[model samples]
Target: MDIMIAAALVMRPDGRTLLVRKAGTRVFQQPGGKIDAGETAEAALCRELAEETGLRVEAGRLRGLGRFRARAANEPGRQVLADLFLLHLPDGMEIVPGAEIAEARWVDPAGAGIPLAPLTGEQILPRWVAGAFAPQQAG
Candidate 1:
């Protein structure tokens, strides 16, 4: 079965991204959760971010980063279809862990030391390191 989720690629000015470990989970992942029935992806992301990270974000502030499919991090034999977004947080915004989140941290995209969800480790990190989502240069 495929679980539909909305995830955020939360970035800081220093070029590090945020990852969270949910309570009882070993793999760190982008802060998000399953989309509720009738909810848009952006709306689901906004709600998940607030619930998991205590960061209230306006849906309009999120930029579409593309969707990714990977094996579910905590659920064996399950797939995850994630709608990802690029979210740039303002300097010094404190991220408090909420709900199921056990811990959160900022890590360099190139060599994140902790274990990561397949979606994060296999797909998202490589794209980030290659600057696939970097702002376009104007000629």
Candidate 2:
């Protein structure tokens, strides 16, 4: 079965993206997670953002979609349906790294660092940074 989800492409003021290390673990990923059964993808993004980062986003235009087969990092071998968005973070919200998150860090999207969300690194993000996926294809 496919796990439906949503996530944010949260870029900081310094051009770095916000990535979270899963709590009690080392897998790095975006703040958002699986969308609840009755929730719209955008609603899920907003909800997950606040839950994971203690920040709220008004989830604007549709940004893109992330499709992949989940692997490793405790979520091995499941298919994922993710809706991605460019979000706005509330100013001054501290990163508390909630239950599912161990640490939150902002890093250069182009630089080397901890591996990002498994499928993201291999698809969306690289293409995102390279301008391969334009805003027109958001929805």
Top-scoring candidate (TM-score) = 1
lDDT of each: 0.91, 0.68
lDDT of 2: 0.68
* Per-residue lDDT over 3-40 for candidate 1, one digit per residue giving the tens place of the 0 to 100 score: 99999989888878899999998999999999999999
Question: What TM-score, to 2 decimals, does candidate 2 have?
Answer: 0.81
Off by over 4 Å in 1: 136-139
RMSD of each: 2.1, 3.1
- Per-residue lDDT, model 1, residue 4, is 97
User: What TM-score, over all chains together, does every model reach?
Assistant: 0.95, 0.81
- Give lDDT tens digits, candidate 2, residues 21-85: 88667667766888888888888887887788887666564354544444434466776766766
The 10-residue segment with the lowest total lDDT in model 2: 61-70
Clashing pairs in 2: 23-102
